[model samples]
Target chain A: MTLELKDVSLRFGADTHIYPTSLTLDPGSFNILLGTTLAGKTTLMKLMAGLEKPTRGEVWFSGRNVTGVSVRSRNVSMVYQQFINYPNLTVYENIASPLRVARIAEAEIRKKVESLAELLKLSPMLERRPGELSGGQQQRTALARALAKDSDLVLLDEPLANLDFKLREELRDELPRLFADRDCIVVYATTEPTEALLFGGNTACLHEGRIAQFGPTGEIYRAPKDLVSAQVFSDPPINTVTVTKRGGEFRLADMAAWAAIGEFANIADGDYTLGVRPHHVSPLARGENPVGIDGKVLVAELSGSESIIHFTMHGATWVSQSHGIHPFEVGSQAKLYADMSRAMLFDKNGTRVAA
Target chain B: MNNKTINHAAWIFVLPVVALVAFNAIIPLMTVVNYSVQETFGDNTFFWAGVIWFEEVLHSSRFHDALLRQLAFTFTILAIEVPLGVAIALAMPRKGAWVSVCLVTMALPLLIPWNVVGAMWNIFALPDIGLLGRGLNALGFDYNFTRQPGDAWFTLILMDVWHWTSLVVLLAYAGLVSIPDAYYQAAKIDGAGSFAIFRFIQLPKLKRVLTIAVLLRFMDSFMIYTEPFVLTGGGPGNSTTLLSIDLVKIALGQFDLGPAAAMSLIYFLIILLLSWVFYTLMMRSEAQ
Candidate 1:
């Protein structure tokens, strides 16, 4: 089903949980709600599922105003972050509960439950109770239950957040294919930018109960509309420096000037915030025509194939992520360079300045 | 992890409780065991009985009748109270200022002394002037609890239910409130009706509390004495004479201490066995 929110907002007593926001979810598409904690992702999903009534505005599902409809009347299924299954029921019974509620025939319930268990890799543990299974298996039972309902919309609220890193990685790779051919709108909420990127769907970036940007996931990651979107969408955090823009030249902290790229010619000369991702900022002499800066290394952390270097320059601490091992001792001086063509600029109001 | 040296002196702290139990429970129980195995008469003179009292009480028709009545009463109350309590708990408001109000009201019945509860029901169900009795008679029913055996049983069961169902309600309410909201939300999204929600979520969650409620009520009702003794005095032709009342009559009223002590031991054993069975069954299902 196509789900649309027309200027929906939610207020809990004196605190506003969600500002007025409108979004339309295409049917049978995977949609990702990406944000940090307390960014109103769960609230938005709850409103869409009819679990909470919006304080104002309407919720439309396929042209019907369902803002006041009860959750039981809506054809939707939700899996919570905490593994939630009927504790007294076996895994097979948990997956079959919804079908039983609908009074489906016994044969159909068995078939559907078995298929979902196979898909989620829970078939071997179907007879075991929820408490007896591992956390990942329990969450997979919850997922299978949600899938067996065959509802029009499936809402997952950070369903894999509680699992360990190895299990999370495994499930993250399998989720897209699990829901690939289902004729339902799948909405997944996550705080991990990498998970959102891997899901490869439409993403709505939220910040402090407001939608900062919403578009195709890859496009939004590549070109965020504002500084907040960039900060929310980046994992290691984008590197930013206050710079003054003069005609054809950009001065950093009034210390050094660099010729502006041809794409930035139309920007009027004024103060602007320059943002460069850590991957684009690296050790000097590594890239052609790179902008160089001097800094004292504060900390260096090497993990797997990359090293994250924390350094202080121009009275501000900045991070540089470089490939391979680059052992820069603390308090040691090092030269860093940033690829000018990959840098982003924002105005004083935090809006991105288009190239 | 903090590694600390173990102190053997911790046993000293528990000595007071051990002494209290020895005085209160062990001494009294030993006295009853002594009485059961020997015959006692005036001046504290004792003679060896060698389980004769146990044989007499076990073979007596009076003991059989009292045991049957006790079982009937216990099972009846369990049947009525468990479901009724859960229903009332489900109907209670989950939040707001009214929750405390409901709780306080439910606790009122439990706070009254057992004798006072029996006396109050006795006066309230008097057929001549009591409201319930007069009202039922006026509505064209012969409802005289003091004169008829069936009416006496009816009034006795009703009094016990009114006095004790609140305990079950409180326990079930506690169980209901501890369930997280996510379960309800998931049930709703799964298109479950109210009955389905209760069957799948609320009932399963309440299993532990209900087990506790059932076991406590069973033990309490089995040893019920004061209330019925105060209300009917096991009268109306001994219709409401439960085992505890019968035991008291044997030990105190007629001073037949031998049979009474034997019956008391048997009573304790029965309660222990039944409660063990109940707890084991409940915990076993929960483990699964």
Candidate 2:
């Protein structure tokens, strides 16, 4: 079903849990709610699932106002972050519970449960209780239970967040295909930007109980509407430096200047914060148009394939994620380069100045 | 992980509890064992009774009748209290100021002394002037607990239920509250009705607490003496003379110490065996 929230807001006493926000989620599309922890993603999902009523505004499902409807009356299923399965039930029984509640035929329940269990690779463990399964297996059982209902809307609230790294990667890869042909509005919430990108769906980036931006995932990542959205979409955080514009030249802390290029001409900048992603900021190189800045290496952390370099530039800390091992000694001065074409600028109010 | 040093000093802390158990449980149990094997006449006179008293008590029709009555009472109350307590717990409000009020009221019955509960019910169920008895008689029913065997049984069972069902309610409430909200939410999302939720979610979650409630009620009700003894005084026709009352009549009233001791040992063993069977069955089901 197509779900729409019109000016929905939630408040716990005087504290606002979710600000007034409106969103329209089309059916048969994979929708991603991308945000950091405590960003109101779960609250918004609860509102859509009818688990929590909005303090104001209305929820429309399939063109009908359903704000007053109970969760049991709504055809929606949710898989929580923590693997929530009926502990006393076998995996097969867990998957079949919803069908049994619906009073579906026994033969249909058996067929559906077996097929879903096979699909989730839980065929062998179907007779085992949730307490006996591994975390991934338990989550799969929960997923199977949610899927067996064949509801119009399926919500996954950071469903892979509790699993180990390897299992998360495996399941994250399988999610898109799992719901590929399903005629349901699948909403997946996650804190990881890469997962949203990997899922390849329309995303709503939320920050501080508000939807910062909502559009195609790729488009939002490429062109964030505001500074918060840009920051929320970045992994190791976007590197920002305050710069002032005079005529066609942009001056950074009276230390460096570069001529305005392309869409920068449209921005009437007095003082603007320039944001460049960690991947875009690299070790200094002498080829082409590169905006260079001097920084002192603070710390260098090397993972398996890449190293994150923490450096101080213009009295502010910045991070640069370099492609391979590029170890920089602490307290040593280094120069970083940013390609101007990939840089983003925001005004004092944190609205993105497109370039 | 196994390389940690063992602390011998921890035994010092455990010594007090061991001594306490020995004093409170083991010593009294040994005394019962001593009495069961030996016969005592009066003024420190004693003789070897061997297994004769056990055989006599086992063959006695009076003991058999009291045992049957005790079993009937225990099972009857178990049947009534467990479901009634769970239903009451389900109806109780899960939150807000009323929670404390409900809990306190439920606990009030449990806190009253067993004899006081008996006394209170005895007056309350008096045929001529008592509120319940007068109300029932006014409602046109022949209700005289003091004179009728059926009414005596009814009053006894009612008194025990009123005295002990609160324990079950408290335990079931605890089990119900411990269930996470996620289970209910998931049930709702799956379109489960209230009965389905209770059958699949609440009942399964309450299994452990219900087991404890059943076992406790079984043991307590099997050994029940004070409440019914005070309420009906074994009744006008011995209708409410449960095993404990009969055992007390043999042991202290008529001073038949040998058969009474043997019967007490048998009673202890019966409770032990039944509790073990109950625990084993419940655990086996849980494991499966």
Candidate 3:
């Protein structure tokens, strides 16, 4: 069934957890809610799940208004960030809980529970309680339970946030595959932009209780509608610098000017914010129209495959993430090349100007 | 030669606590043991008596009656209070100003002195002048706690339940509040009804505190003395006489110190054995 949230908003007194928002999610592909923590991704999910009633607006499911329906009455399932399971129940029972609630036959429950357990690699721990299991195992049990429900709508609220790094990676690769055959609308909320990109689904970038941008995950990453969307879609954060376009050249804040090329050349001649991904601004000159700028390096970090450098340029601190090791000394001046062709130009109101 | 260095100074730090324990608990217990085995006549004259007091107390019909009465009272109160307290806690407001208000109201009865609670109920249940008594009589039911054993048992159990159920409520409420909201929300999404939620989620989460509650109430009610003594004073013809009251009657009323000490030892053993059994049973599921 197609789930549509129409102008739903949640307010607690004067505080708005989620502004008036609308989203239509369909089955087949994951609809990712991509944002930093407290960006109202969870609140919007709660609204969709009927856990919390919206202050205003209606939720439509398959062309029916279900705004006032209780979560128990709806065919829905949710897995929380905290590995929430029936602590007193064994892994087998935990997976069988939703089926039991639905009054399914015992044989059917056993069949579904065992299959889901095998799918989650929890067959060995079927008799173990949640308390006896590891964090990842518990979460797997919770996921198995959510899957066993086989509901039309499944909400995963940062389901891997509480797990260790290795388990998160393990689950991340399996999540999409697990939900592939299910005829349900799956909504996954996450704070990490890289996770959203990894999922490669439709994404809604939330910022301060509002949807900054909503489109295909790759599209939003390649061409963010605004500076905020770009920032929300970047890990080390999209570096931004205000530059003036005049006389067929771009002049940065007290920095050298470079000839405007491609999409940058086509924009109107006015003061605009230029946002570029950290990887685009590298220590090596590689892209078209590369402009070099010198700045004092603040910190240099290397993570086996790449070196990330934080430097201050024209009173604004910017990061340069490049492949391979190029360690720069702290407090020393270093010149970095930024690919102007890969930059996104935004107007004074932060809206993308260039195509 | 041993290479390990031993630190003897740690013993100095533990000395004071050991001394305190010896003075308060160990010495008194030894004295009780000493008294349990010997018979004392007038002031300084004493004679060794082998398990005679124990045999007498154990086989006596009087002790049996009081033991049965005590067991019945304790189990009755536990049965009434635990579920009632849990129900009340579940019904209480989870948040807002009403939370503190409800907590304070629940705590009011607990804060009252044991004797004061017994006295209050004693007066309250007086057949003629008390509100409960007059109201019951007005309702035309033949009721008199001072005369009937059944009525006395009712009054005593009611008084105990009123005075102590809040302890269970407070403990259960603490357990209930510590559970994260995610469980409830997940249960809702899983299509669990109210009883299922309680049975699967609330009861399991409350197990730890409920264990403690049942333990405390079990021990306290099993060895109950002050409240029932003040309220009924063992009542007319010893019908309401519990173990503690009977022991007191033996030890002080008849000056039968030897028998009382023996009975006290048996009482202590019973509580310890039962508590261990209860704890094991309650925690047996967890070991899995």
Q: After superposition, how far is residue A175 of candidate 2 from its true place, in Å?
A: 1.5
DockQ of each: 0.59, 0.51, 0.77
Summarize candidate 3's per-residue lDDT along A1-355 as a digit string, tens digits: 8899899999999999999998888877698998999899888999999999999999999899999899889999899999899988899999998898889999999998999999999999999889989999999999999999888999999999999999999999999999999889999999999899899989999999999998899999998999899999999998988889997999997676899877776777989898878999889997987899889999999999899999999888999999999989999999999998888899989999978
How high is the DockQ of candidate 1?
0.59
Please give the range of 10 consecutive residues that has the lowest summed lDDT in model 1 chain A. A281-290
**Candidate 3 residue pairs in backbone clash:** none
User: On lDDT, who's better, 2 or 3?
Assistant: 3
Candidate 2, position B49, lDDT: 78
Question: Residue A305: error of model 2 in Å?
Answer: 3.5
Count of backbone clashes for each model?
0, 0, 0
Tens digit of per-residue lDDT, candidate 1, span A289-344: 47888999999999988989989889878899989888888999988888877888
Give the worst 10-residue stretch by lDDT in candidate 1 chain B. B187-196
For model 1, the docking class works out as medium
- lDDT of model 1, residue B85: 98
**Second chain alone, TM-score for each candidate:** 0.95, 0.93, 0.98
Specify the poorest-scoring 10-residue window by lDDT in model 3 chain A.
Answer: A260-269
After superposing candidate 3, which stretches have Cα over 4 Å from the reference? B1-3, B41-45
Candidate 3: which docking quality band?
medium
Model 3 per-residue lDDT tens digits across residues B165-189: 9999999999999999999999888
